[model samples]
Target: MDEDLMRALREDRGVKATALAKALGLSRVGIYEAVKRGEIQATRIGRRIVIPAHVARRLLGIEMEAA
Candidate 1:
């Protein structure tokens, strides 16, 4: 992975499932459904399910501006 992208990933605290869903015009349940289907990578941080920034970026083919 790119070093700058990794750094940005760490800084951004990953993408929340709700945010990711909103970005894709998906329902939050749709995001969870994908996770259940092993289509997306995510982890639980307490009560929140977060998609790793790198995985999210790659899945969406998105690029984030460097800090």
Candidate 2:
């Protein structure tokens, strides 16, 4: 996976699952499963689900950005 794409996904608060899947060369179902299994963190936002950038970096074993 491209580190830039990973970083982008990990820094963009509003990055969607579909976009992440495309960027990571992963299926959307795979991303969903990861969320379901708590391998990644996500929260419901109205009718949409969102994953935090910090959580994404953590899941990738990368250092989180400074808040």
Candidate 2 contains a number of clashing pairs equal to 0
Query: Which tens-of-lDDT digit does each residue in 1-67 have in candidate 1?
Result: 4454445465765878877776667899999999989899899889898898888777666677765
lDDT on C-alpha atoms for all candidate structures: 0.77, 0.69
Q: Candidate 2 at residue 20, lDDT? A: 63
**Candidate 1 structure lDDT:** 0.77
Stretches of model 1 off by over 4 angstroms after superposition:
1-12, 65-67
Worst 10 residues of 1 by lDDT: 1-10
Model 2 agreement with the true structure over 1-67: per-residue lDDT tens digits: 6565565655676556666676667898998898889876888788665777666656555674565
Clashing pairs in 2: none
